[model samples]
Target chain A: MIDKILSKYPFPESVKLEIKEELEKLNLSADKIKALVDRCYKAYTQNLMEPEEAAGIVAAQSIGEPGTQMTMRTFHYAGVAELNVTLGLPRLIEILDARKTPSTPMMTIKLLPEYAKDREKAKEIANKIEATYLKDIAEIEADIKNMKIIIKPDRKMMDVKELKMDVLKKKIEKSLKVDVFEEDEKLIIQVEPSYKKLIDIFEKLKDLVVAGIKEIRRVIIRKEGDEYVLYTEGSNLKKVIKVPGVDFTRTLTNDVWEIYEVLGIEAARNAIIKEALETLEEQGLEVDPRHIMLVADVMTVDGELRQIGRHGVAGEKQSILARAAFEMTVNNLLEAAIKGEIDYLRGITENIIVGQPIKLGTGDIEVTYKFGGKR
Target chain B: MKVRLQDHILVPKHEILSKDKAEELLKLLGITREQLPKIKTSDPIVKEIGAKPGDIVKITRKSLTAGESLFYRLVVD
Candidate 1:
């Protein structure tokens, strides 16, 4: 049935086959499928990149033109305290640079259907997400004369976080290997009677985890549209996904590297594009998604996340001259010569450096004439 | 043990194309394995399906802007 409709149009074999496959996927009846096919065929024909078209240059211009209008500073998430998200130009640069850690790492967590509707469950989730330190829930005072640390438990804070004083004392004792004594309102931790040891012990006491997950410093659950979504200041994609009521499939971290670690290269590629476009869009700048996709593709074609600039994608180019043209010119050239590396002279940068047309579009093809002509 | 790549957010729908289907695809496209996009043999999904180097893998993905799209890759070591 698809073949019959597709045969009516004098389309390329590839186009006809692709249209047929797409129509089958649409799963429409014969008449509807044919109509959709015609529409798709029209769209495809209109969208074809022309022969000899410089796609790379066009993509660069498309993204770079709108980028100039982007705002410079980060944007803070509304209602979230000091939850500043890196946006606009800086964030775009960060994504392309493939920074090891984002300036402001965050997670957008969705909950399971049951938990999504309940306010109480969302609060519970928020509490679990907010990392709790002993210093946050207790008043600690170091007595130099006695060589001891007194930790006065904040009963309200402990109660709110659902933490037990006894459990906190046990954890401190195990981790710090200090003698902990339970008093009426305060827990006394006996420290070694040396100035240096006492100082060391006092420092370790400050960062002890009293309750809740680590890494996630703050979490705010807000109702967007209908469901309660969690916006966290810190991110731990691997651990957060393990939480019982989380909609694991939909939860995402803004940190591309973290996404790469948890979800692999393909997801990282998508994250890079998403992050770049979001940054641009936040500042009311618009660029084609195809351009962003091309950038993402270049960054991840090797099955690994790589930055666009030096120390990553640029530095690792197969052509030595191309690498040298990017940065550290002398160093690159010297290293390449030392290694007896051969330049393929295939890439755009290398070809352009020698004042030749780049191997793209028309430049990518070659034609040779035979001495004898066939009759 | 390694985590399943199928659970990855952008892995898409991966299938190991049978020999006959792969041959037919190559004929239809008028291209060789070298011309197709490359997927590393070490890639988690490629490994998950137990595809060796030189085998063809078909990937179908839902693009936000382009709807459903298909891609082919030659698994390479």
Candidate 2:
């Protein structure tokens, strides 16, 4: 049936195969399948990029034109209160800029099948993943006379964070290197007699991450569909991917650099494309993902994430005039002049600058009429 | 890390080509070894697949423009 449709409509294999799969699931009649395939074929044909078409400029304008309409706001992500994500133009710029870290880095973590549906198990995972500072789960004070830093772990909060007293004690002991002894329901760290030493211990202990990965500031367990999903306030993909009970395969983070570091450049390129498309889609703008893919390919083709702006892609252009046109016009032109640079006039921007037709689309062809075809 | 590179959604399919296959691919694309994209020897996927320097890695990714697309990279230090 699919072969019949394919032979008639000339559908791409991928699209045709996908349609056939959906049709099989539907138990559709033969005529119905053909009609559906026909409609899909039309849609596919319309979307195809034309030969010799200027895709780069079209992609730029496709994304650039709609980008103006996006609001420059940090949206409350997915209606999850207090979780602010940089959206709209700023985020698009951030992705394109290939910033080392996103202004608001976050993760969407999936749990293993057993832990995914249970609120308790999900909370446990969330607590284990979230960075829990001593200040967040305990009360601390400097006893002036005794030269001691007293930490009183909140029983209720500790329980909620799934933290045990001994585990907390060991972590605190390991980090501070001072033996902790319990006195009157408080953990005490003896410091040197100097007032400065007491102050030092107090400050140091205050910010100690007694539980979980330090980079993950907060992990909220929100029920998404049938499973509880972990949405994080801050991202720590490297550490998070290693945590037990996390469906490591399904975990996602917005830190492209982190992805590059942990997963390599291929993954980073995919992230760039995925991130840019999401940013555009979130703003209710419809831009072909291919445009974003083209941009991403440029940014990551060299196996390193290079920004789209002056410090990266534009700055490194082969054509002097193109680079000069992008930014730092004086600096680029002056440097080119001093170096006796050659302008090939091969690139679109350089050709346009010299008042010549760019070697693109129709301009690329010198003769409209070809030599007569052989009989 | 407990995660396998293969399991990561962002990572595309990567396979190292034999010397003869690599030569064919380069010739087919009408490009030199230097012209192909470079993937660092230290890259996690490169390390995972045990691809050495001068090896050509064929990457197949589910692309947005075409349903699937092919990419080649020169493994470099």
Candidate 3:
């Protein structure tokens, strides 16, 4: 039965063997095998990428042309102040430029199965992750006459955070390396009268962390589908994933660099693809994922993320002429000269500049003439 | 801090080719290490597979839209 199908179709040897192996495993008749073989042949031929095709140029145009239409604006979180995610053209530029830190980093935290379904548990997790500073929960006033910094703790905020006054006083005493005393409800941090700079001490007291995770600025618990998801304003993927209740498998961050640091370059590559695709789609542009994949692959090909322009992939091109053509032409040329570098003229840009056919497509082929042919 | 690169969901299945197989692959593709798609020697999969510079590594990935696909990269510095 396998021999009959093999002889009937002009499939490759590998394809024929695959069909034979598959047929032996399944209880399929001759008719079904024929249909399966036909379908496989169609799919294989449809997916083949032609050799010598200028794929890079096509990908560039596919992404770059629509890039012009993207609106130049950062999207503010709805009804939230100072929480803006860079989107549209600016974000697209950032992704391609391979910016180390995004303008507004964020994370979407998914809880473990047991905690995911409960709102109260999710809120508890949010409180544990959200960072709170001393200034956020206290009014610190500077008194020049007494040479003291007055810290008036918000009792309601302290109670909500489950913080004790004694702990707060001890924390301040230890962090500032100074004596702190309570008068009524106010905690007074006394600066030495001989201390010349009383204002410096007051500024330092305002920025101290009072509670919660350091990197996570805000965490909002919002129910999505069947689970309560925590949307955070800042990203701390490495630390956040270690939280006991976090579903590390599904927890994701918008910062590519954070992903790289926590999960390595492979995750960073995937993040680049996702971020680039979202940026384009947000502006109503339709592009093949393969193009984005190519870009991501190029950016992380060296096991590190690199921008498309100078100071990254382009600047580090092996070909001196290629680097010169990109930007800082005179600087590149001078450096290459000093280094006594050799330009092999192998790449597309260098070849084109010198009026030679690019080493791509038809130019990649070489036709050598025989000394004496059978004429 | 040590990062577990192999545990990443995005990392594909990777295998190092033996000397003969690597030579055959290069001859069949008619390309040098510089011409082939590059994978850094420091890449996690390359480190996991114990592949050296100039060695060929085969990567297999399962894509939802494209099903299973195979790719090759030459390990480089």
Candidate 4:
């Protein structure tokens, strides 16, 4: 019956092979296995087959013979039914047909506290203490030990406020229990041992202030000769000179100058050159913006402004598009103005034809045109 | 010739037995607990229905080749 049932279903060849091997190991005759398969096949078609039905057939046929102790366990649970088969007989066959194996290499690490003497035990204790307590020491080492003090007055005065500085220093010392020292223009406070955490807090505050200032201010860059320049609008030359690494000699300052006084001379020159091109583009010209910038950089001598074009510094490498495009843009703008004038005249003519009084002058005006053969 | 007859034990077929009753039944059959394998807590079917430990799971076995067979109900906690 089981064999007939197995034949009706399209069981995979692997599963069929497994069943055949199990039957052979159980010493069951081919005819007996065929008869069991036929019975299972009949049950499946009749809808009388259950999960355990298949399991029990496999179990009884395989384990009923001698030396075969297979067990089929079935479970009905809240979720779904399940069947499990234990191959005790096949396991015994494997054990009889098995081979021996060898071991492999390994390593281990062990602490030697048990074998330690007095000094070694003390050293181990200290190491353990450091491991547990000194986890944050390395991270705290980067914070500044001294506070950086900055002072700026709302209004400028010839005399410095020495008393105010002394009082401020005293107040900070009293509140934080830290030593305050005055350098040339700044006050530095040494961080106390108890307030080491404040070092990181203060550093973070400084970073935030600096970032805020940078965000509020608009700094632009330009190219001058072989270098770049940095400049901020409406800033004094002295303010620009204060920036480190600047070459002050090459910097120019006229009423309408394009020189950068900050950082290296090359940087200043670049800023001026970039600004010159931007100025030209702002005039609604069609010059390739990059060409104007490059020409400005090459034309400027030692950061001094110089004109660039056919008769100027870049005459040898003049571009026809640069000149033609500039001319065409100017002409187009002029044409637009003339069209506007024509539209104005047409509007006046339409108003007159409709017999409306054309508002010409604000005050009383003389009648220049003959209306109804003049009065 | 006179024949002696033994009284048959009456069993309720419709009464569903709990895990404790099943254990009592197994005791009557002279079977040890080790003879029955346990259902693991991590079994997919048990977890799918949210069955916890100490819950009884019943199974019915019907085989065409060997006819009706006995099965075990697991205590899945």
Candidate 5:
């Protein structure tokens, strides 16, 4: 689908050929160029970078001197790093073309003894040991065990000790279920039974510190009168909402959208109704925008607000009498009434004929029969 | 085949020929493959005619500016 859209766009063949040649000169494959283009496209659509920024990077590599290779390399490296984080190693592993099967192939082990003399003697001892130990251990493996570990860092000469303590703490955390604490000149670790196997795994992974994986942050917006109030926990709402045209007044309150925008939608919906109600009271006249929110929510899908035109809001019911009278007199009368005019004589007469209390859109509330029932 | 030569340039009977004829002409000429420029799959000119890889494309060479020559690509399949 994306290819189809790109096809319509008129990129000059000469330019494309030049780009291809440039890529060839750099020893980059067509696939790599495509991947870079895909990253640029994603960044462009996500509003992360301008099209010019993507184009500048592409053009610079294509026409600029070899000295600019460093900049190009940096751009590609940044793109790949982001891509790796977005599609984590586990996902990439699953999609790897080399992996035909889901399960990894097991390594076969062959043990050799040190010497011929010791080999025969070791075999006999191993056979006897395996017969007794392996049989009992295999049978007892069905039992489950629980264990815990706590870790503490050292104080006094803290700076030097801190580095060593962190390394040790990470090692313990990786290998076992452990908690760490900082104390004077020592680090304490508490460990559990299941963590025993992980001790070696952590030792290996200690050097591999994964960086650049970003946690998605959300923003919340609350409707206050004619404007939206934005907030987020642990974030400076005052500073963030300073975007031009956005109004921010801090008071004790919550709105679903505001919460959703700041802390994610699920948290906003799960907000306690009681707490919301109390907050609404505290911030008077700022009714838990939830009332309008509920109406709007029911009328919308995926949280997008649709406009309520002259015909009334979508997915809402109109009265039978209103619907019937809509074509003839009601439309004009409603328009006039909206303009603040009242014809009491016509209203009472219509009420008597319709055999119902006529609802008027204008003036003071007083029911008076000013005309006979014949229209 | 008796080929007519006008002013030392080869001239064929047909004014325009199909892809088969064009390929045959290129083969008849002593020109190497690299002399002919490659067209990319993503090229808009290739897309305009809905051509894919391995398809023969014909373009007219013209000079628009005083010193700049541009290739105006026509039909492709």
Candidate 6:
């Protein structure tokens, strides 16, 4: 019924959808809906861009002006000392740069209903997701005279991490290729009788990943409302989303490139907008998200996440002059000369450099009829 | 349970346009099919939707300003 009413409006599908939702709640009659839609159509058309308008310049100014106010800092988590998220201007730059891996890549993982509601289940998921090193749960002491490395598991930390002695022993034996056996309620690793081997085993054992997902260094489970949510220090979206009890749809990583690799370009575009908006919002600056979206669209329009700099968008401009003007001026000009490259002078920057009116507004109208054929 | 990339919130809805509709879109935009933004045939979404090369996929993106916006991408090798 809504589609039928909206089909006749002739407005863009976007406009029709919004109006349809508003109409659904009011339970309005057909005539009332038509009158309301007519008003909305008028507003939408009025908001539409004029032909040859320079939206790019407007978007740049909107975002750039507020970008000047952002602070340079990484937000530190007071409760979880190990986690520090890149925020403010640095983060904004990182997002626009389309960095392959964010400086401090992290994920906010939401669990399924069964896991989220129970603290124990949430902890189990966290243990399964976080990488647990031997150093995290045990102390390794090399008895120099005896040429043996003693692995003493802290029972309390073991209990908290839910790591059993047998599991720890097996992981140690497999990685270190040493004999690990129970000794006086402690796990003892017997290395070669050589002094060098004992020291080597001790060092290797400290860094060994005994449990959980290897990429995620830490997973902090925090109570948000009635449910528990996990915040991870390192991000591995491809693996985390597959883990049982994880609400994959809701799991999000700060790294946009990972999203592109796993979910495709559209998700990466959304990630770019989301990450940028979050960085800006964190700094208490409320620039319009549309400005960020414009940037995101350009970066991902080619189905590849590209940085806005010389190495990506600006460097790939059709006009040689625009590319040369952006950066590596001498090199770009030299290369273009060597290649006999032509400058179409199509873009705003290049046209401005040549002292010609840019291809925007009146300059864009090359063949407008002269009124009354005036001289 | 298996997960589909299309089911993600950020993915939006993707549908392969009919040949006639694709030509109509090209004519309306006054651009050739090659001029449309390209999505790789290997793209996870393209693979999921089973769009072949030369197919035009319509993407319905949920927007902040507009309630939703329609985008078209040419599937390319």
CA RMSD of each candidate after superposition: 4.6, 4.1, 5.1, 44.8, 32.3, 3.5
Ten-residue stretch with the least lDDT total in model 5 chain A: A210-219
- The CAPRI category of model 4 is incorrect
Ranking by TM-score: 6, 2, 1, 3, 4, 5
Candidate 2 local lDDT, residue B49:
95
**Which prediction has more favorable TM-score, 2 or 3?**
2
What candidate 4 gets wrong by more than 4 Å, as runs, is A1-237, A242-276, A279-375, B1-77
Residues A63-129 of candidate 6 have per-residue lDDT tens digits of 8988899876666453445678888888889999999899998999999998999999998999888
lDDT of 5 by residue, A7-45 (tens): 443334443344445555676555676775565546545
Model 1 steric clash pairs: none
Clashing pairs in 6: none
- Candidate 2 vs candidate 5: the lDDT winner is 2
RMSD of 4: 44.8
| Per-prediction DockQ | 0.29, 0.63, 0.30, 0.00, 0.01, 0.63
TM-score, every prediction: 0.84, 0.86, 0.81, 0.16, 0.15, 0.87
Give me the candidate number with maximum lDDT. Answer: 2
lDDT of 3: 0.80
lDDT (C-alpha, whole model) for all candidates: 0.82, 0.87, 0.80, 0.35, 0.32, 0.86
Write the number of the candidate with greater DockQ, choosing between 1 and 4.
1
Docking quality of model 2: it rates as medium
Candidate 1 is scored at a TM of 0.84
